[model samples]
Target: MRKHHAQQLYDYHVWANDKFFARLKELPEDIYIQEIQSVFPSIAETLVHMYMVDTIWLGVMKGNSMAEIQASIASVQEITKDNQLQKMEKLFQDLSAEYQTFLHHESDLDKEISPEHPQFGRLDTQLSELVQHVVNHGTYHRGNLSAMIRQQGYASVANDYVFYLYEGKAEK
Candidate 1:
């Protein structure tokens, strides 16, 4: 079957995240947890935030209740307590695989969902839109991650969508 627009964007999101995480792992190990005065305290903390949000959204997409979502987030928090970048990367990869499986089996990309949030009130949107929001959220934080790396005088990887496209073509 042909891919939906949201699925394509999600694919790009996973590819881009993998690229950034791989580059992050290549840097000095300390760099991952190095204290920084930014939106987040450190790269490790920022990654944890990214991972938590992704987990929350995935739970939401799967029709999980708020309690279940909170549980999922708490579980991830436990994993991040050690501040290990490798563990964080593995979490991302595992979550990405889950999303891949979800998208693969999802038959209705536009199915309407009403998920109420404590702060944002309620969102009445389609599954596809929620997927898009997740991708956008990831992109925004990846930018923050890139800047954090630069602030520490480290080079950041290029994870633009066009690069993902180019790499796909090159691999064929």
Candidate 2:
């Protein structure tokens, strides 16, 4: 896809994440750290993983080592210990701002980036592909969040791409 299309997708990703996170904030604080049987163990873990992975990809794009990326965000203990939700909100806000600035200066979506992960091996892909992967990755885990929310007897927010579009954010 084109860089503009990728930017739109990333914008939608941020919009959807905000909707889900806002809904999460309405729930009792304990529910976020409560252990549950799901993809990532608990709501807090899932959210933290999303932030970590997003940071990793963005860091790689910016030419940082994995160690640098991991050190940039809060530790796993801090995220699950106290003020977990607030920490996540701040993390996403910071990451989203950096992502927007990166995109604004980006003009070569077709440029190839080879980022390696110890477990996932190495990827040889275009920058646009990495951007799309970030969007898709968030969407998948947001579904997990929806299920987790339902398990807690609460309704999750609507975070569909169409919903974002209908909200007129797609025009931005």
Candidate 3:
């Protein structure tokens, strides 16, 4: 994939994330932390998981091992919906900037990354593929978050890629 393509995908990822977070904020604070039976136990846990995965992929792109990335975000164990939105927002901003910078500087889309997973061992993949995976991963969890919101009797935000396109975001 081209850098511009990855950039557009990342742009949409950020926009969608913001829209989801806005809707999440509209709910009563207690709902954010309420445990439910899903991919994650609660909206807050799902959001934190998304942020942590993004950080992991970003760390891998920067040449850090998965173990290293996990170690870095270990402090997040104590984070909760009650006390972590501000910090998570900062992470969102920083990761977005880092992604944009990575796209700007990398000339090769085919460069390989083989981040080691402790349980699964190592799998070789292209940089551009991983970039796409990160966006897809976020989209999936955001859908989960939406379901959790509705389970709490609140309306969730629409963050579909079509909506992002209809907002006049540049496609090229």
User: What lDDT does each candidate get?
Assistant: 0.88, 0.84, 0.80
Off by over 4 Å in 1: 169-172
C-alpha lDDT of residue 83 in model 2: 41
- Please write out the lDDT profile of model 2 over residues 1-172, one tens digit for every residue: 3348788899999998899788888889888988999998899888888887887788888867878766765564455355478878887888899999998798876688888887898889888888899999999999999999899888888999998989888864
**Poorest 10 consecutive residues by lDDT, candidate 2:** 74-83
Top candidate by lDDT: 1
Per-model TM values vs. the true structure: 0.93, 0.86, 0.86
Residue-wise C-alpha lDDT for candidate 3, range 1-172, written one tens digit per residue? 3236777888899999989767766768788889988889987788888887887788887778666787868845555345456566676777788888887788876689787778899879988788889999999999998899898888899899889989967465
- Judging by TM-score, tell me the better candidate of 1 and 2: 1
Per-residue lDDT of model 1, residues 1-172, tens digit only:
5588888889999888888889987899888888898889998888899889989999999999989998997898888798687778888899999998998899998999999887889989999999999999999999989999999998999988789888872222
Clashes of each: 0, 0, 0
Residue 32's lDDT within candidate 1 is 86
| Better candidate number, 1 or 2, judged by lDDT | 1
> Looking at candidate 1, what is the lDDT of residue 88?
83
lDDT of 2 at 70: 66
